[model samples]
Target: MSTPTASRQDPSPATDAWLVIPLYNEAQVIGSVIGAARGTFPHIVAVDDGSRDDSARQAERAGAIVVRHPVNRGQGAALQTGIDYVLDRTNADYIVTFDADGQHSPDDARAMVSAAREEGLGFVLGSRFLEGPSPVGPAKRFILGLAAKVSSRSSGMRMTDAHNGLRVLRRDAAERINLQQDRMAHASEIIRQLAATGLPWREHPVTITYTDYSRAKGQSLWNSINILVDLLFS
Candidate 1:
């Protein structure tokens, strides 16, 4: 088995890399996740996409810069809002879009930022497929792996984890991402956009913990089929 990469500190200083977390109805996990991320990244921005629960308050209490939307928007929309906040509020050199759940690790967060800084890549994706401790079940893994392959073929990027949300993007590449779909398909669309724009991108393996809570919040098997159907039909 391949060993985990050594954790390297971000050489670009603390204020350059901003962690952007978009959440909806993740009150149960938001606080803990924010606290965990805060251990590594100082600038953590959490966008509450009109969650019905008290996710915003939890994030704020956990030391995240909370930005609340008035109505429930999709994950893609929430991500866009967070990106906008990063562009407007801070002079961030790199922006990392992290999940609100505990699937992503703080070690991987720092590594991703460091990779982006050192490698001069426009974006770096935390690929669960390449990374160890991938928590997805066999069936879901097969489906997602196949989808990622298809996305790679379509985008000509040879990406390992096209749909993983834990990713870091340079300021220019991130600002160029315009999410057209408000739903889960935005994951695939992002690859397409990056490919079309010829952005320098790389994928690094990271651990994914598929707890019962995260599984419940994740895209359903039915939703996967719906995403493809929407992409094909639209």
Candidate 2:
């Protein structure tokens, strides 16, 4: 993947962590998401994945540093671009992988970063099922649960949610991550690579707000099944 140049600079003070958001065609909610997150996390990098909407402009207006991909890339590629941007351009100690949609919570992200710092953990994965049942539909819940079990067996790292878009990785663990699966399969690929790092990691309970818009944009059952197959064969 080519390095994307930042569209603008973030005026916030240098912090210990940076939120890396993989932005696509989420112009409707990306601005508010970044605005709310900026209250807790000042340093945010939104990698725009060739969005045809106004996502890049909205993110820039919300005070986030925007990195634009010249063409449409998969989420994994967008995430890797954001990660590389943080590592190469900033001095942050932690990198948080946050969703561009308004599903993930800024509070959860802040808490995960706090846990990583307080517990000396290198990786913190967000799990929607850790604390209790999530608001997802029954079919989606079953699919995700099965995927998590399969991922645990294959990667040797037990996880309650395999494809959750919220995660915190310290600089060292972030450096070890090289996502080759440039699509939905990268969710499981991330677990496999992170497990190989032998870093201290744990799952954190996170709330996923499935609003009407996010629900409409959620992955389909067929795609979920494909991710399972990827986990099994990759």
Candidate 3:
């Protein structure tokens, strides 16, 4: 990984939380996403996973700390690098894993962090299926539901949505995470590792807005199957 580059604006002192975004080639919308998220949570670190486009520059211009990987590492490696950077460099008390795509709501992220702080919880995972039916299509919903059940059974933690990217981890809980799965399978690996930490955790109801852009860039059905396979084997 290259040395992290920061924008001119400093992190706001309004909140003690930092959002860790795994960035790929979302140059078209990354600036807007970062701008919107910074309104609520000022500190953001966008780990650029070797994007060929101008994503890193856009994020940096939008007031995010840009940490570029020399090559195309997967999302898991990007996330781990962002987490490690936050732990090693910042005094942030909470770390939030947010997607570079615009599917996740900044409001939901704020709520999760609030819930974690209010309840003295170390981990708060976003669950699309928590309050009611998720907005996902039927086939995708079914697959994700099945994946959640399998993850819950294997990890010994009942989760409604195991693959949601939005999550809040207190410093103590973040310290316990060491992701070896440097790919999409890290979603399940995260649950297993967090459960092993035995930290108090809960699922927060969250809304995932599946925009046309996000749908186009979202994980494919084949990739979902690969995640299941990885969960079972890894």
lDDT of 3 by residue, 1-234 (tens): 011122133333427999999999999999999999998889999999999999999999999999999999899999999999999999999999999989888888888787787677888998888677677777777788899999999888888789999999999999989998899889999998899988887888889887778878865666667777787787
| lDDT: worst 10-residue window of model 1 | 1-10
Worst 10 residues of 2 by lDDT: 1-10
Predicted candidate 1 versus true structure: per-residue lDDT over 27-126, tens digit per residue: 9999999887776788999989989999999999999999888998788888888889999888999899889988888777788787777777788878
By lDDT, the candidates rank as: 3, 2, 1
How does each model score on TM-score? 0.90, 0.91, 0.92
Q: Which wins on TM-score, candidate 1 or candidate 2?
A: 2
Q: Report the C-alpha lDDT of model 2 over 1-234, residue by residue, as the tens digit.
A: 011121222334327999999998999999999999998899999999999999999999999999999888899999999999999998889999999888898878887787787678888998899777688778878888999998898888888898999999999999999998888889988898999989888888899987778767756667677777877787
Compared with the true structure, all predictions reach lDDT values of 0.80, 0.86, 0.87
Candidate 3 wrong stretches, greater than 4 Å: 1-14
TM-score for model 2?
Answer: 0.91
Clashes of each: 1, 0, 0
